[model samples]
Target: MTAKVLNIIKILQPVVIMVVVQISLAGVNILSKLASIDGMSSSILVAYRLLFAAASTVPLAFYMDRTIKPRPMLTWTVIGQAFLCGLLGGSLLLNMYMQSLVLTSVTFVAAMSNLLPVITFILAICFRLEKVLLTKAPGSMKIVGTILGIGGAMLMTFYKGIEIKLWSTNIQLYAHESTSTNKQDRVLGTLIALGSCLSFATWLIVQAKLSKIYPNPYSTTAMMNVMGSLQAILFALFADHDWQHWKLGWDIRLVTVSVSGMIGSGLMVALMAWCNRTKGPLFVSIFSPVCLVVVTLVGTLILGDKLYLGSVLGSIVIVLGLYAVVWAKSKEKESIQCIEEKEQGIV
Candidate 1:
């Protein structure tokens, strides 16, 4: 009985971590939206987030990972990891995504985030980290899953069906429905969101590679945050020359940066790196849909964001796709394990 309980706990550990990560991310989304409401620059917000994340993680990394002696040859992988995670994934992705939320609804942005896993899968295949076994069950499932996920994202992007009464409280949508005033903005937001997804996917792939070279998830994530903070600050200074926008006061902006930095950047990315190291990028991305669901409900309840028919339908499709891919991966892992067992004469 004791051994069984331990086994169950081990199995459930990642699931619990993923749940916490998703919840923190969902809250960060809402907080970011609130910060944007007060005319805060997304770039500045991201800069602060990275800075805070670095400040928090650096000490922990140094203290806990003291045994990890860095070698000179590891510089290249560190550079790649820093660029991918800090500049492209952390700063650029967050800036674009937050801006997307400004123009689009939270659910819409969250729905688009489901594209991360599909994109990551494709990148993994490209990098030869994953094989495309078209004749195999795993390959077939992945293909179908990718198609379904892309279809769902497209549906959510292009189709906003008749508003659902309870959640269609967005003033922007009401104003733009007939006038089509923000159509351009919406298109731009969608494009930006796509870029964000792609950037994040690339980051995940690079992170996986980095894990093999560094083998210290906490230190690696801390370095990425530090690098990303510097990159973001440079961009923020150039983009917004007005120093007025950088002010942090006793308000939602402070809360936004604090929570976003501490939870979203610091805790979430570190946990994700650990997950990526253990389970690969696909596993890390599989939990994105969970974040989406939580964000959808939270957006509707707190922000009075619209719950479009298309969003509901697309989210369902995306979730189904996520499950299909997960099932396929599990089967693939089982088959590999069985082969290894037979080879070792343990079966």
Candidate 2:
């Protein structure tokens, strides 16, 4: 009985970890949105967030290096890859995402982010890392999922059918600032959010290659965060000339940077790496929609974000499509594993 309970706990461990990761991410989105409303520059926020992430992860990297046997030496090639990872994932992707958050609503940004798996799938095919076996059910489902995902995003972007009032707390975090955005700004924000998704997809491809070369998760993450901080600082300097924008005060902005850095970049990365190793990336990706749901509820009730009919419908469609792709990938992996097991038995 004791052993069975232990086995059940082990089985549920990944699920619990992923739930925490997603909730932490949801908090980041909420806090970042609040900070943006408090007049924080998105670029400056990115810089400080990455800086904090680097600071928090460096000790872990050193500890891991000391404890793990047969530590891999960091080659120049690995450094180059880390630079690319920092630029694509940390600096570029985050800046665009934060800027989009400022331009758009938190719910909108969260809903749109559900497109990452679809974007990654498309990118994988483009890079020839994934194949298109149209004759197979998995391949067909993937194609179908891609269409649904893109269609859902488009529906959400172009159509604001009706406003749905769920429940408002009547309490705005930043009530002084106007939440209304012009249609042009909304369109631009949507485009920028899409671009961030693409950047993240590209980063995943690069990170996968980097992992193959250097399997040390903590060290690799630390290096990427350090490089990303430098790049983001440079970009922020050019983007905002007001030296005051760089100042950190005892306010929500400071809290936003600290929490987002520690939770979003540091802890989330570690959890995701562990999950990927244990249950594969598909298992991790399946939880993406949870963040969206949590954000939508919190944004509506606490942040005073409006709920739109199109967003509701579009989110549902996107989640359905996301699951389709994840299911297809899971099936493909199972088939490959089964075949490998059979071959091993025969040998």
Candidate 1 lDDT, 292-335, residue by residue in tens? 87877766655667677887898889778877888888899999
Please identify model 1 stretches exceeding 4 Å from their true place. Answer: 67-76, 167-181, 342-347
Q: What TM-score does candidate 2 reach?
A: 0.94
Worst 10-residue lDDT window, candidate 2? 172-181
lDDT by residue for model 2 (1-347), tens? 69999999999999999989988999998999998888899999999999999999889889876877787878999999999989988999999999889888888988888898899899888879789799999999999999999999988888888889886567777664333448888888989999999997787677767777788778888888899999999999999999988899899999999989977988787677667656755677788888998999888887878888888998999988998899899899888998999989953
- Score candidate 2 by lDDT: 0.86
Clash list (residue pairs), candidate 2: none
TM for candidate 1 is 0.89
lDDT of 2 at 149: 93
The clash number for model 2 is 0
For every candidate, C-alpha RMSD to the true structure in Å:
3.4, 2.0
Candidate 1, run of 10 with poorest lDDT: 172-181
What TM-score, over all chains together, does every model reach?
Answer: 0.89, 0.94
Highest TM-score scorer: 2
